[model samples]
Target chain A: MMKSRPIAATLAFVAAAGLLLSGCSAPAGAEAGGEKKLTFMFRGGEDEKKAYEKAVEQFEKDNSVDVDIIVTTADQYATKLKAAIAGKEVPDVFYISPGDVQAYVQNGIVKDITQYVENSDTIDLDNIWEYGVDSYRYDGKRVGEGAIYALPKDVGPFSFGYNKTMLEKAGIPLPDKDKPYTFDEFVAAAKKLTADTNGDGTLDQWGTGLNVQWNLQPFVWSNGGDWLNEDRTKVTVDTPEFAESLQWFADLQNVHGVTPSVAEAQTLDTYQRWMKGEIGFFPIAPWDLSTYQKLGFDWDVIPYPAGETGKSATWTGTLGIAVAESSKFPEDAAKLVEYLTANKEAQQSLVDAGIQIPNLKDMAEAWAADTSTKPANKAEFLEIVKDYGRELPAGNTFNAEWYDELFTNIQPVLDGKQSAKDYLKEAQPRMQEFLDSANQQAGN
Target chain B: MTTTMRRSRLHRKEHQAALVFVAIPVIGFLLFTLFPLIFSVYASFTNWNGISAPVFKGLDNYTKMFGDRYFLKSLWNTLYMMIGIPVGLVISLALALAMNRKMRGTTFFRTVYYLPVISSIAAVAILWQWAFNGDFGLINQGLSLIGIGGPNWLQDTATVKPALIIMAVWKGLGYSMLLYLAALQSVPRYLYEAAALDGATAWQQFRHITVPMVRPVTFFLIVTSIIGGSQIFVEINIMTPTGGPEFESATIVWYIWQKAFDNLQMGYASAMSVVLGLLVFTITFIQFRLNRRNQFSID
Candidate 1:
């Protein structure tokens, strides 16, 4: 009986200890047998998952290390990643969005890979687009100026996806794919393309749709306006140029009645409407190519319409692969990041899957020339990236919050409940306050 | 001496067995519930961003709530949603009373009513969203058939709260009805018979006898409903991504989730959670006192 009691007590203690330690134990992929293991995490759709799985398999076979690839959906990625970081179960390598890079770097959750990149024999830093690389660079105070913390997976430039069938049905000439339309010309074309085909009092079809928050950069930037100055220490959105551009964008839906109302858009949403051949033009990116290929209607790509400045501009959505600072094998993780990003063969597989554009400057031309792809104006994507693509203001810390705040307040302006001038006048100071605090925190 | 030693050993063995049974729950309570509660309370007084070490900020997080428009709006929205509790109780009790009588297919009807309670919140919210959609929703189509133009139920700020409240009441009706059904079954049949002999109508008997008999159950449902209503998050999150057009449908718990997870403002979120906890506690306490006073008055 005495022997049994001690054994039972010891078993209970061990069980309790196991329960507690399981949470904080080594990574699930850590050092199986003699092979060192790497935990890689990313978020994407099924196509991206398949592409990444192939790449990981190749990487594992060549490197003699076991790689555990964790894939999450886009919606749950941020929350899951944050929870993982807080719980100290951070993946050795992960995909970081431009908006989150600053926060991750500021918290020292991501390792600085500048030294690793410089020391690598296979990677040529200059071969990648500077803006794409700059999105992940942080110098403690500002982005675009210091140590590279991540490698760019893709540089996606937002452009116009126009319904060729709809334009032809309206007997309207297609806008030049190489040279974008002037603002007035675009508006006129949109008005001509819009119609109420069923003879109902309500308009059944719209010329274009804009996701006020995501698609605002084209108008703001082409009109020679910006959210922040070069240093990102001040808010530049209060200028007359910005307000006028914003007012013009809102007028397309309100005064012009070319775009669907907020409530009407909720019925089918812009993407669905575009797929149904209802919208004349909608924002498109490289990642959307796979989905767009399934559309039955004739469609083509075009540059964003130019503003008074006669310049076309849009935001680039860049995804970067970063190494976790908590990783024990930072060098091995760096090697994996390099293989996934800098290796042309690895990128070509993803590119062939229509999930990404080539990150290498020279390779993009060849990739664009491949006639097997959809959106016949594929060359225009490269032109926009090379000529006019700008990083979203979200690349800066706290700027995303201010950007969201602006969108939240500007709804009234778009609904025609308030004027843009009055709204911007009231909003500029609040935005500046956010920028000031962020700047101070960044030691600017 | 040998017998005494054997008795002591048996007692020790029984005591050990009792401890083994108790230890599992004690460890769970400490590790899962108690630890998080204490840690969250501490987190409320700091400025932790989930990634960095928390900096002690004393009363700053608490004071900041006063100036936060979103926080105040969420609190008001939460209280506004509690309107569903009373309305839900009345409807459920009426159904319960009707079903408690000699009725055909009582089990079938009860199962039908309880289906929504068993269904996942995500599924319910998605179904309700489709029904409440502005343009192509079922509700608007029905209204149009009646020559009435339905307002945008989910999009417009003015109508969003009522739409959410209607959903909450519908979702809660089944659970509340089951509780009332059980309570009504327990009421003495003699009381109703005696009342009927006194020529009391069905309404009078229900008002005077059944209501009083079910008061304690009613109190239980009310307290739990209030607590549940105040923490409404999933429905609003699924139905309205931006908190229903300018934060109109934002509940306190939803706001806390956004702050903690979305904005990484864990400390501020924790502070708001503490406040919500206190609010629930105070309300429950007052409810208990009121119920006690009512019982005394009845006596």
Candidate 2:
């Protein structure tokens, strides 16, 4: 009996120790058995996932080390990335949106690639847009000084994409592609589009549908109302301009009864609505053109309407490949990042897939010329991005939740349950407090 | 001395195997549960963003929690869900008794009613989201047909939580029903016959015999449902991304998620979780006490 007790206790101790060792083992980069394998994480649907996989396959063939690719859905990306980073098991290479770059960079998760960029023969940092580079930089340090966290691979430029057939059917003159109608004229056009064709009590078609997501930020920016001040430490959304623009937005639902309430817009697929020729004008990213083509509507791109600020501005989402600081082979990972962004073939492949605006300066025109692009005025689409586009602001707290806040806070105002003034007034202080608390917690 | 030693040896030998069998799970529970519970209790007293190292800040999170509007709203919402558990219990028990009869296709009917409980919460939440859509939803349409206008079911503040309650009850009723059905069928048939022969009506037979026989099962349902209902999260999370129009449908778990992820206030979130756990524990304890006291009378 004594002999068995000792044996059993020893076995139990061994089992417990085994579990603990498994839990605390070194992450992927450490204790390698072969040519170090680096993980690249991204989020996309099947098509984009396929493109990324193809790029990774090519990268693996060129490098001695194996490249592992992990793809997450858009909704799960932020949550998973946060957990992975916190666990200190982050992928060696990953995709980070420009808005989230600051958060990751500030937290010391990403390695700066400045030194690598300086040494690389293939990638010309100068050719990359200064504005685009600025989006990824923090306090004058380009993402991780001497090591780039990521290189810009795709640029999602926001612009107005209109249904030419819908405009023609409604007998509304198409706005100039080069000069979009003024903000007032834009509203008038929308009002005309809201009219019922069947003369039934219900309107079968609406003038336009606005996405309650990130799309509304452009409208706020157009009115010269910023969500936060330049320092990003204070919220500045309760100003007269913000209130007026929101009032205009609300009028579409409440007084003018032209567009659906923000909540109703949530129900409708904004891209699908524009594609089906049910809506005349839609604010969308150029990346959406591929999906828009499936509807086969006679559509074209237009510059953002000139707001009271007079400068036409559109919000942009930038995508890039970043290297984790804890990477096994930092040099190889850096090279791969550079190759994915700057390699002519890879950039052409991305453009060919109609995924996004490739970073190379000359690749801008090729974005429109890729054989896969079926838009009637593809050049005009690229032109809109080149001529008038502003990258989205970056900060430590910039995330999907920011837009969710805007949507939820402004929803009642849009529904006429409250005035825009009252809503924005309440919202500004609340958002400010949220950001302040976040800043305090982050020790900014 | 020899006989006592022999008995001790035998006892130790018998329990050693049982000890070996339980050792892995016990260690796992201690490490994953007990250790974290202790660590989080320590963390709850600190100001932690989860990125940097946590700094000790005694009682600050708890103090801040008192003024948090969303936290209070979620507490009230949790209390409100307590009402649904009893409503769920009565309906489920009634259905169980009906289904316990020797009817044709009884198994098929049971499967149909219990299906929602087995389905993924995400799918059910999504299905309900569409059904609860303010304007074009089937529920609203049905209401309009019956000359009763549906208040914007998911959009309005007052109606949103009630809409979630209806969904929760619908989702939960099946499991309790299955439990009660088992209890009903297990009751001896001779007891009902004896009561009937003694001039008992159907109602009296049910009141005197079936009710007593199912008292234990009813007690089980009440306890499990209360515990399950208090921790309800997936429906509110999946359907109402922004906590159901002004945070009306925000439950305790949903509030914990918002605090941890959205705000990155892990310290505050941990404090809230401790309070919620205690709240559930206390409520369940009181319920069990009351249920045991009433068990004999009901039977």
Which fraction of the native contacts appears in each prediction?
0.29, 0.17
Docking class of 1: acceptable
Classified by CAPRI criteria, candidate 2 counts as acceptable
* Residue pairs in collision within model 2: A112-A144, A112-A147, A112-A148, A113-A147, A113-A148, A115-A146, A149-A322, A150-A321
**Per-residue lDDT of A1-444 in model 1, one digit per residue for the tens?**
663686487568758776677845566456557677889989998888988899888888988878888889786787888888988889999998777777788888999999999999758998888878888888876677799999988889888879999899899998888788998898999999888988988787888988777777888899998998876777888889899898998899888888876644353467778888889989888988888889988898898998878888998888899999988788889999998897878888898898778888889888787777688888888887777888877666643556656865666787788888899988988788766755553442
Interface RMSD of each: 3.4, 4.1
Query: For residues B29-69, could you state the per-residue lDDT of candidate 2 as single tens digits?
Result: 99889998987788789876555467899999899989987
Which lDDT tens digits does candidate 2 get at residues A1-444?
555766567677777688677755457656446667777788888878887678778878877668777789876776777778767788788887665665566677888887888899878987765545555665533332233556776667777767788788889988876665777898788888886678887676777777545555666677787677766678777899878777877776777766653356454445455666677777756577567667767777777676677666776667778888878788888888888888887776776676666677777665566655555556654554465566654333544343345565565776788988888887776677777765554444
Q: Provide candidate 1's TM-score on chain A.
A: 0.92
